[model samples]
Target: MTGRLWPRGLRARLLLTFVLVTVLGAAAAAWSSAGSASTALVTSTERRLTESIAGQIGAITPQLTYPPDQDALDRLRAAVGPDTLVTYRNLRSANGADTGLVTAALRAAVRTRKRLVAQRITAGGRPWLLVGIPIVITGPDGARTPSGIEVYAVRDLTGVDRQIDGLAWSAAGTAALALPPAVLLALLAARSVLRPVRELRDTARRLAAGDLAARSPPQGADELAELTVTINEMAESVQTSMATMRRLQADARRFAADVSHELRTPLSTLTAVVEVLATATAGMEADARESAQLAITETHRLVRLVEDLMEVSRFDAGTARLRREEVDVAGAVRDCLRARGWLDRVDLAAPEEVLLRLDRRRLDVIVANLVGNALRHGGPPVRVAVSASPEQVRIEVTDGGPGLPGDVVPRVFDRFYKADAARVRTPGSGLGLAIALENARLHGGDLTAGNARGGGARFVLRLPRNLEGA
Candidate 1:
């Protein structure tokens, strides 16, 4: 819940944190000042009251008789003020009003020590201060003794409390005043911090989107600036590496295209020579005939490899064009199987007449490659099924094999990738599935390979029904 409520942006969180800290600091200072001032005011008031009461009693004591009577007590109370209590030998001041303000503790302390003692307390929901002073007699020898005369005074502290409360409110006001400035400072700080971050973010996004030229400008000699510099250096390295890779790839493709183009004429002459040799093999001796057949077979394999490379070069150079036609998909698959002499070897489960507009030659090539791959690499009982939807047509080919290896599935359609590296010689030039996938994608469709549920390798080809503008 706290995570949900907390600010997600750096600037907002920074501002909130700054304001809270400022307000809390101001409040703490205000509270301390108020408490200290309140203590000083109360202490000063208590001291002054004690001194005044003592002075008044001392000035009037000489005029009263020793072992003073009611008249002396009444005179003492009148001189002290209306809130004073003067008592001697159980004769209390008749006119005093706040006698209850003095606690028994204060009275006992004053009587035992023969000195002034004061206490601050609350009465009638208001603050009050009580002072108890014991009068003493001095002999001719300058020795003092208790005189059994005590004076008590009560002073209201309501005014002091009001002053303390004002101080507290003033402190709170100061804390409140600190907010706007704190927020303003926070905004300035956030701008300074987040500017470089925003630039870095934009630059990183551009780099991810393939704009290798993107770079962030360093702002100041801080951690963020250092990070910006590092990122710029990394981008420079990546740009250099990508440039080198692209040059190498272009050169490699050009070399393959050149080789394939150069070999086509000689390969044509060789094919003609092999055809003549095939006709002459029946008349030659058994050993010579077998050697001639092996030579012919290798020459044909070489020719196929060169042809496949040429086709791949065309794809790489973006010269492969699609010729779309409205054709029955089932009939095309059947024709592909029949032409390749695989009609009896595979099971077909296609509808009689599911039609789509697509490149007929490309579809033929795709089906031929898939079925041939299954026959060459997988177990027997190959299955081919054709289906159609409103948007696309699907051709699924499966073989009763152990299924594609987990590591091989990902790279099955990768150009020239083979599962068994040690078994280098195979009938395929290794470009069959790759070329098939390219053709499928050229029609705005896709091909996928995986393991089938019934335990075999499965290849599914999906081509869009409409090839208009594709």
Candidate 2:
């Protein structure tokens, strides 16, 4: 889902959204500003044109008489420009020409001696502004007459349409010039915000991959900094807790080792006394002899258990030292199987000489535990495989019995954790798989347990070829 991809992280998605919105808002503002400026320019240009034409007529009125000569009027209109046309009602008769685009209203204005102006009117099917002013005529007594000639001028405004086009092009040019910088700034801002989010994402992935010390770098005095600080603190807390647990686990392993060492001397003395009692058991009753033999066997099992526990404890305490040597992996498996009387039970599939640097005692412990577990609870005829790659050696032990209980599979290497508790109520200690795992780890290797496909358990051991500081 999109929600899964985005998450609730503040820095991830907001940066992109911010950039897009800012770009859109800037474009809108530029468009609106261009439109408003164009409107204002058009209105102001029209007003200026109106004032200029009115001023020109007012300034020329004193020099011109009513029913002025058409030649002088034509000269005045020619001075204005080709786009400007001037006409008068009485002058039209004097010139013997009809006034262009002039109506009867202009004649009335001439008779009343007044001015008339019309804006944005149609002339020759095109828009124009028409202005008319009455000219006063002086009589022999120098008195003004009630009736006067009307002079009108019509100016074409097609140039206004051209000016509007020019204004629109200018606005578009300005907006175009501004857009590149806006896009660049938006990209930079987006990257700045997304950087922190990318770092956080990588850190989260590292943490999930079991690197508990992963943390994000704090940036500024803002909400992002606060979040970074919080994530770093959480990582620190997790690291501290894991360290404490490892230390406690080491202490517990040391305690077990100490107890095993203390029991060694007494157990050796008990074994010697049991050996002496076995000689007299031949003259005793059958049940008494059987009981004595059972005690001795249990004592022997206890001795092996204590020794394995001590080795495991040594590994946990970081006190286990490896005696590394070049040895044939196949030979080791064969020897282990022979010692456990399981040579017939296991099918060895290996080369004649697959050499590896390993500690012999630790390797023996790993092999023995796997074989013993297969023999005891993994049914008959187990399969033992040994192979070697260029960098490591692999040992596999498989059985045909029912696989380990599903719930107990993950914790099989945990100390004292046992499945089928009711079936394993004897005096034997539950430290075989744990010791095997510890020994494998001590040798720079690993032991893994899983269900075999043919309805059984399978244990695999992988060890590095070069066991220098194992």
Candidate 3:
């Protein structure tokens, strides 16, 4: 769950990582440059000041009297430099009242009469260098004695501080300028990398959704491009396999249709011969007459079965064309019953004005097959009802009989499926409901079967009102 809080997209994660790296690199660069520049400026300032102050001290010391009057010390301070402070123990010259920058240890070191010492210190929140040296004044004799004059120079470092601050700001600004270019580079890199991945994902989704033709174009010669090529190859394989399967299915259906068509001629001739034989059998012995009648009945059933097979083949081959015309639902239903001599057998309940643009022949075939199926397999009081809405038209057939077994309802409209699993001889070819379903689909509609409310089988043929859907 903690991973949910992380960014879900690759681009955002890449951009964030790039930005962090950029900022860290920039900050490091700024810090390094600022430190070097500040150190250099301070060193240069110290070197120049030390040399100048030492030269001035050398020139002024020999001209001074040992244990000099205050006037000599004042003149020594003036010769050092502007904004420079000089001190000799309790005696000082030129704005000497402010002496806080000098520490007690530095004053003691100067009293030792040893070497020159310099240290940086802050006075009144401004940087200053404190340099101290003890001078020996040679008397008129050939002997030298300590002058006890401790000279101090406090050099103002305000200008050096300002220069160092400016350098720091410049370094920061230089680092800041790098961000725009870094951001642009990050965006370009993310786009170049993620575009192909997005395309491949979309293509994969289309393939999953049954678009076998979906493919991705290979781009660069790198690994991503190789992946794209692999995906395209897989899609082509699927397309080829599906195409072969479809062609084989079409060939099988075509063979069945051709065989059914070829058998029709011989079947017709055989039917005629059987009819003639039936007439002649009336004069023959009783057992021979019974055999002739049995042959005749079997030949008729075979003829019907072959016709149904041909019809199914035509639907499979997409050769079944609709003859669309405006037709009243009630009229279509009534005509379907009358053509089969079943008007007196079934009750019709329909709306007079409900109409649709659909194939009349297919409609009649659908109604006849359903009514015949119900009558042949069910009890009396077969009822047909036609209903309509703005979007669809419906015809429902019901019969007063035992409803279908629970397991048979779902597969009742499958081709060659039988409600009775036992091999009891039945008149139908087991394709009546299947053909009716195909006819309904031809009109861009559907067929469904279930039990009616009063314990009977029900078949509803629903057709869309729009013929353009076909």
lDDT of 2 by residue, 1-470 (tens): 98776647554355546555665676567667767876786577667766676677567766765456787677656544444545554454312122365667655654554554544566666656555655455578999653444456566666766766776676667656666776677668767877887888898889889899899989987887888888889889988998999898778877888899999999999989888987888898999999999988888888887887787777666788878888888998899888868788788898899888887777887888788888888886688888888888999899888888889889988877778767776444688888888878878899999988888899999998777766
Query: Per-prediction RMSD in angstroms?
Result: 3.5, 9.2, 8.9
| CA deviation > 4 Å runs, candidate 2 | 1-19, 36-222, 225-247, 282-294, 389-391, 404-409, 421-428, 464-470
Off by over 4 Å in 1: 45-115, 120-128, 148-154, 277-294, 405-407, 453-455
Model 1 scores worst on lDDT over the 10 consecutive residues at 93-102
Residue 80 CA displacement from its true place in model 2, Å: 19
- Per-model TM against the reference: 0.84, 0.61, 0.56
Backbone clash count for every predicted candidate, in the order shown? 0, 0, 0
lDDT of each: 0.90, 0.74, 0.85
lDDT of 3 by residue, 1-470 (tens): 86887787889998867877986699788879889989988998898888888899888887876567888888887888655556566787754544556777777777764667778988789898887777766667867666767667777799999998898888778778878888898899888998999999999999999999999999979999999999999999999999999999888898889999999999999999998998899798999999998999889989988999999998987888898988887898898899889999999998767778888888988998999999999888899988988888988999999989899898999988877779456888888889999989989999999999888999888898788858
lDDT tens digits, residue span 1-470, model 1: 99999899887998888888878888888878878987898788778877888788889888878899988898988887778888888788845467767788988898887788888899999998888888888889999978898888888889888988888898889888988898898889888888899999999999999999999989889999999999999999999999999999999999999999999999999999999999999999999999999989999999999989998999999999888888899999999999999999999999999888888999999999999999988988899999988888899999998889999999999998999898678888999999999999999999999989998899999988777878
Q: Model 1 compared with the native: what TM-score?
A: 0.84
The candidates, ranked best first by lDDT, are 1, 3, 2
